[model samples]
Target: MNNNTQTRTYAYVAAVLYAAIIGLSFLFVKMTVSVAHPIDVLAHRFALSLLVVSIPVIFGWIKIKLTLRDLWRIIPLGLLSPVLFFAFQAFGLVSSNSSEAGIIQAMAPVFTLVLASIFLKERTSIMQKLFLLLSVAGVVFIFLMKGSGMSAGNFKGIALLLLSTVCFAGYGVLARPLAQKYKPMELTWVTLMVGFVVFNAASLIRHVSNGTMMDYVKPLGDASYLGALAYLAILSTMFSTLLASYALTHLEASKMSVFSNLSTLISIAGGAWILHEPVHGYHFIGALLIIAGVLGTNMSGRKRGLVIPDKA
Candidate 1:
């Protein structure tokens, strides 16, 4: 096959990998955060990610030529993702339920679609738009079927969650060009470095102020916590970011964003298999909707006989 087709195929695979990693991350996050503060968990996760990515470069097995100027350009992408996205999500879930967070996150495609159109100059056919909405509707239906837990009248929580989606969307849009410009690992390295520095500094500040510096490393003593932290750092944060960057190199931001809905289905499956959560009838139905919507969104609208690319 041709290079473009080959690249496109790899892009979709990367998108799927990113989605699956992110989908399973909720499970891992639960494992890590149970024994440590959320901030501390984030700190450890990024610290590990940065260390892992930096090793290849330090060992002369990989090469990167990032200057201060490159960091300035890439910093916005970093801010949009691991830093702001996680912060809003951690705090947002504090006041809202999983169902609510699910519904809010499903709108990430809509956010990317709009941002890509305005900022990235990407276009979509009418059918693609409908399919996108259908996918979103599936996610909403699944979450709404989840029913009310504690009502969230807390405007703060809702706002933060919305901001989280926006940041992710913005990252997808902004990263598309940068992904094409830099090697995937280069972008992933910067992202991890920024997250590592920001989160660790924040954790350090919190510890200093509260005289809880001793408690920071206290979580590392647990074997389970260490396992969970490793998964999050190595797979979720580092590998997922690399996959996303690689996909963005060949896919449009708008197309890449829709794959996020697949994660909802993955999350459900993970819960059922690992957490022993019951798989309700609604889940099967919602899963069908999600799968159809994703397929349709990708397959239905092709101006030049090509579906757009999108992801987490």
Candidate 2:
């Protein structure tokens, strides 16, 4: 295959894999946070991810090329994503249901589209804009349906999740330019390292201040908690980020972001099957709109052809 075809193939594959990883991540987040504080979980997840990713680079199996200037440019990308994105998500999940978190995350593409248009100068047709609204309407529909459940705590969680979506969307737009200059592994490694240092330091300070230094390690004992943490650290954080960085190198950020909508369906199903979360009719309806919006927003317009008159 040609280089363009190969890159597009990789982009599509990465998009699918990233979607699946993130879809199932909500379950693990919910599981881990039940026993550990969100900040503690973030610290452990990034620390483990940094360790796993460092092995290859440390052994000379992987070489990452970066100058001080490059580091300065990419640092903001890391801060936007793994640091701010996951921080918001970890805390949001603490107060919100996994299903709600998943649904809210579907809005990331809309944010990405707008950001890409503004920063990357990507064009969006009127239909694409409408479809983006459709996707958002789906989320609003769910919130309204759950009007009775809109406690102040739930509202806070929802707001945090939306903030996380914006951070992640910003990451998508920002990573595209850097992707042109860096290898996926290089970007992923730097971002993971940044998250590791920031989250661990923050957690350490919190633990020391509260005299919960020992409590920070308490969740490590439970096999279930450990398993969940392993998934979040290895698969959800590291692998998914690697996939997303690679995909962004090959695909437009707006198009790549649409793939995130697939996670909503997966999260809803996973929540129902694994967490035994209740599913209402509105969930299905909202999911349908989300799916349609994803499809419509990503669809390419067809060219019109002039037809010659047939001989009589």
Q: Best candidate, lDDT-wise?
A: 2
Tens digits of per-residue lDDT for model 2, 200-310: 999999999998899889989999999999999999999998999888887778878888887877888888999998889998898888878877776643123211111
Q: lDDT by residue for model 1 over 207-251, one digit each (tens)?
A: 999999999999999998999899999998999998999889888
Cα lDDT listed for each candidate: 0.82, 0.85
Top candidate on TM-score is 1
lDDT score at residue 78, model 1, on the 0-100 scale: 93
By summed lDDT, the worst window of 10 consecutive residues in model 1 runs over 303-312
Model 2: weakest 10-residue lDDT segment is: 302-311
Model 1 spans > 4 angstroms off: 94-103, 152-159, 305-312
Clashing pairs in 2: none
